[model samples]
Target: MSYGPLPKRIDPRKLAEREVRFESSVDVDQLPRLVECLALPDGKIEVDLQFSVDEQRIRTIVGSARGDLHMACQRCLEPVEVEVAATFNLAIAASEEAAKQLPRYYDPLIVEDEEIELLPVLEEELILSLPMVPYHQDCSIQTSFGDDAGAVDADGAESASEKPNPFSVLAKLKGQ
Candidate 1:
């Protein structure tokens, strides 16, 4: 089936009763906020969502979103490809007030008009899941200061003469 634009507004009540399932792909360009951080935002994001009612008769949305984004590495300022993914279990609340009482396990999704926009929701989750500073898992930058100044010596050895004898302080205190 041709997956077109994902639904903007989702009616939680009907979706919960019918236990609807949704699977779609959205182009990277469609999510403007997410694109701003990317060095290359050329791929499509996959979204898989399911709507159902819980044992407490509360409407819920359970889903995951996944995609790859090229972000500037904070350390090297080079393009570093990273995976952005989020798995969410959310309770659909009728009002902003109702959302406050939601349990910690379920993040509250407030629906003022009884409908929620899917695009922003998905975009937000992916954005929040991203690292604050995107960088390679194993970055190869040199990280050290000199022994006399910052890190150990070039020979990876610190001579005994370099270290102040611990007993020297005690000798001074004794005035001997």
Candidate 2:
């Protein structure tokens, strides 16, 4: 099914009161912070959000974001395709005190002027979902620095290195 453009800002409390369910796709270009981490910032994020008042009588937003992103591979230093996704349970809070008082299960979305910027919140969720060191499962590049066989003698015994240890000089100086 087709979805409309995402609204830039939203009043969470009002939306929860009305029990709104919002679904949309937003271009990656709209979220600068999320784009900065990507190898190629050319993708669309699919968002689904349901606003309602939970049993605790607190206004809440239950949402998920999904996207195909390209992040630089740490092993090969090339663009690697990655799937990013996140689900969030957020409680609307009017102030810092209210935010701190929220339950552990709900992340606080502190609102000012009864509205919050939607793009940044969504961007944060995507960013948090990204891998710290993204890389392909089987990278094409060979990352081995030295052959293990070369470090062993013909009899399959470990051999001392032919190169002198740089730390040996420090040890000699300490002995003197």
Candidate 3:
């Protein structure tokens, strides 16, 4: 389904009371923190959020955000497109003490005001979803030297086979 642009701020409590579901796209440029993790400033995050009061009377927001982000590949140091997706189950709390009381399954979202900045929340989710080390599946970079197992040294000794085994010393010590 077609989605509109996500609002910059929202009254999550009010939305939860009304049981609102937001389906929208957030611009990449608007999320500064998330942009810092990307190689290029391009792409939009598609988000689907549902706000409601659960059976326990806890106000919560459940949602998923997904997008393709351009990041430098760790293996090749080139731009690679990585798919970032995250799902959040957040329980709204008025204070730190209230947040501490939330169930373990729900992440606490502390808010003291009528409205909260929505982009930062979405940006944080996306940032957490990013891979620690972005790399291509089939990177073109080769990771081997000219060393061969059968090579001999200048003294006519098979260097590879003549290497001392550190474990052998341990075995000798164990025999004592």
Candidate 4:
């Protein structure tokens, strides 16, 4: 059965005991928080994760997710394909205090009332793993930061042409 964007929360302890491995993808459009940041929202995250119990009986999750995202290239101002991947080794925590006490090797994935919010949890990880400023590895883009930055209005009026640099005064105040 398809496993992702799971309709229900999973009991980590039981899954850990069973050694259940979930392989699935959640549609990007299905997650609003995730979709908003995407230039192209019709995509999916490939999830290949599993649950297991550690020697200390601590429930753990280990997995990686890979996917393609369309983000505006910081250098080109054009759509660029970004291959995003994130690997997580997490130990489930029973309480806020317990999360802090988790070992340095394993990040804590907080679980409350015996359940977890799977989508946002994973989405947050993937999102955090994304590059703060994404760009093409090799691209030919000529960007201009000079006077040509003048903007035009819908009626074809040159708004920035000879406009007394309104924000320029702010620079003067900084020295005072």
Which of the predicted structures, 3 or 4, would earn the higher lDDT when compared with the native? 3
Instruction: For residues 1-176, write the lDDT of model 3, one tens digit per residue.
Output: 22587777899998898898889987788889888888998998889999999999999999999999899997788999999999999999999999999999999999899899988998888999999989888886744324543445333355444545659989999999
Which tens-of-lDDT digit does each residue in 37-152 have in candidate 4?
77778778898878999898788999998899888888767878888899999998988899898888999987877776677777888888888888777766644446656665
Q: How big is the positional error of residue 105 in model 2, measured in Å on the Cα after superposition?
A: 0.5
lDDT of 1: 0.81
**CA lDDT, every model vs. true structure:** 0.81, 0.86, 0.87, 0.79
Which portions of model 4 show Cα errors greater than 4 Å?
1-7, 147-176
TM-score of 4: 0.75
Cα displacement (angstroms), candidate 3, residue 33, comes to 0.8
Tell me which residue pairs clash in candidate 1. 145-151, 146-150, 146-151, 147-151
Q: Which ten residues in a row have the lowest lDDT in candidate 1?
A: 150-159
Q: Against the true structure, what is each candidate's TM-score? A: 0.77, 0.80, 0.82, 0.75
Model 2 C-alpha lDDT per residue in residues 1-176, reported as the tens digit of each score: 22598777888898899998889988999999999999998999899999999998999999899989999998778999999999999999999999999999999988868778889999999999999988888775644337643354323455665545679989999999
